[model samples]
Target: MKLFLYVLSLVGFLAGCGGGGVDSIADGDPSYVKVRESLREASSRVLDGLRIRGSYQAEDVFHVSGCESDSKEGGGKLWEAAHFWQIDEVNSGEVQSSIDRLRDSLEAQGWTIVDFARPPQVKNTVVRAQDPKAGYVVRVIGVQEKSRVAVRVSAPCFRASGDS
Candidate 1:
């Protein structure tokens, strides 16, 4: 009985790994293009605060097959919309200052800082911010040794444009 109970508890815990649970509901969006554009614009605002500018290349990853209803019957299979820009040509020396500007920018744009870690605090540096009202998230990741940065903007769980 103990082992069965342990397995059940573990299952419950694992369900929330990537922002799951009862509230993990997907929003309905009619236009996929609009959702894509909006997320890109939001990401650009975060980069606008950075002290350094690098090439912005969109990943164009639409239809991320995870955003779905957390209902008991699992009626719909929704997907998360996400856009990513990889900034190249940024050097390691500029990372620190860039992050500083990034933080200020995030605040100016009304984003709540979700996670932040830098050198001396930890080896790798990553910044995550979220727009509560808009349900959009932005993440900045940089590795000193790599000399490149990646920025990602993701929309909340949304059904495919077809569902509209």
Candidate 2:
């Protein structure tokens, strides 16, 4: 009876230790999707305003900025974590002005600006806009207690024809 109990206990322990049985969560969740959609909508609005002001251009790529990092947590290491957008730009002042309007627009949409800084990885230029330009990331916690969802949007400035 003692040997049998020991065997049963070992089996129970082995079963309990199997992979934790937790559901793997997808990185892209609904909240993140919604945030991304909202940002795209906001981008469209900015673009429309720029167009109305005669600054829209087809060559521009609205750069959304974020971060990458490697750090250890628990027994594992986290490879990357994107920060947020930090700037916006266009070939004309009208596009820049439209992006400037984003501060209020995002706030109204339930996002709070945590902070801002010029990313060092980018080469700052008086004429050309930096890559991963300027903007902010909006975040929401997921259904899982530790998960997060975010959307980043950025716009970088470019030179007009006359300026050197």
Candidate 3:
């Protein structure tokens, strides 16, 4: 896990700094199929940063969100691609470590860390980061009661795969 984190962080950093290396996550006017693939890959890359001792499940791959109420410039409804990867029910400390690693990885990849809150007292917290170019964001949550971690990657609003 440490090695994966180190490598991912480095790759992310380079990608963010215009390297456009293997970890770069940017797509413009992507179709539904393209967005789904991107979202799944993004979510998996994020899950790779976790240092969970136990295993987690990503059986569903990704969850498709309803289209936005408003349309884009061309008047076509927008779609959202997102998914949640839940940790294997670890302790608070482990969950925190995972969150830290996730934040580091995203920052390294060139995404902007917009919001991060893990107040010592607050068990339920979130860390949000966005791809400066595409505006896609990843949200990491620490569930207090479950003592687990859940990471969500949400792609920017996009048109249907077959549209345009």
Give per-residue CA lDDT, model 1, range 1-164, as digits (tens).
Answer: 22332333234323332233343323333454466557646655755667575544333233344565533445455656666556667877887678777977887778899999888898767888888888898888876777777777788865544443
The runs of at least 3 residues in candidate 2 whose Cα sits more than 4 Å from the true structure, single-residue gaps closed, are 1-71, 81-91, 115-164
- Clashes, model 2: 11
Tens-place lDDT digits, model 3, residues 1-164: 53443344334323332221232222332464476556656766677766565446433244444456546567445566665556656865777777888888888889899988876756577788998987778888877667767777788876653354
Give the clashing residue pairs of candidate 1, or none.
Answer: none
Give candidate 1 regions above 4 Å deviation. 1-30, 55-63, 68-75
Could you say which candidate leads in lDDT? Answer: 3
lDDT of each: 0.62, 0.29, 0.63
**How big is the positional error of residue 31 in model 2, measured in Å on the Cα after superposition?**
14
Between prediction 1 and prediction 3, the one with superior TM-score is 1
Which is the leading candidate under TM-score? 1
Q: How high is each candidate's TM-score?
A: 0.70, 0.28, 0.69
Clashing pairs in 3: 12-108, 12-109, 13-108, 13-109, 16-110, 31-161, 32-161
Q: Which candidate order results from sorting by TM-score in descending order?
A: 1, 3, 2
- Please count the clashing residue pairs in each candidate, in the order shown: 0, 11, 7
- Measured over all alpha carbons after superposition, the RMSD of each candidate to the real structure, in angstroms, is 13.7, 22.5, 9.9
Candidate 1 C-alpha error for residue 26, in Å: 17
| Candidate 2 lDDT tens digits, 39-142 | 45444433332232221222222222121332323332221112121222333333223333443454455555453222143222111111222333432111
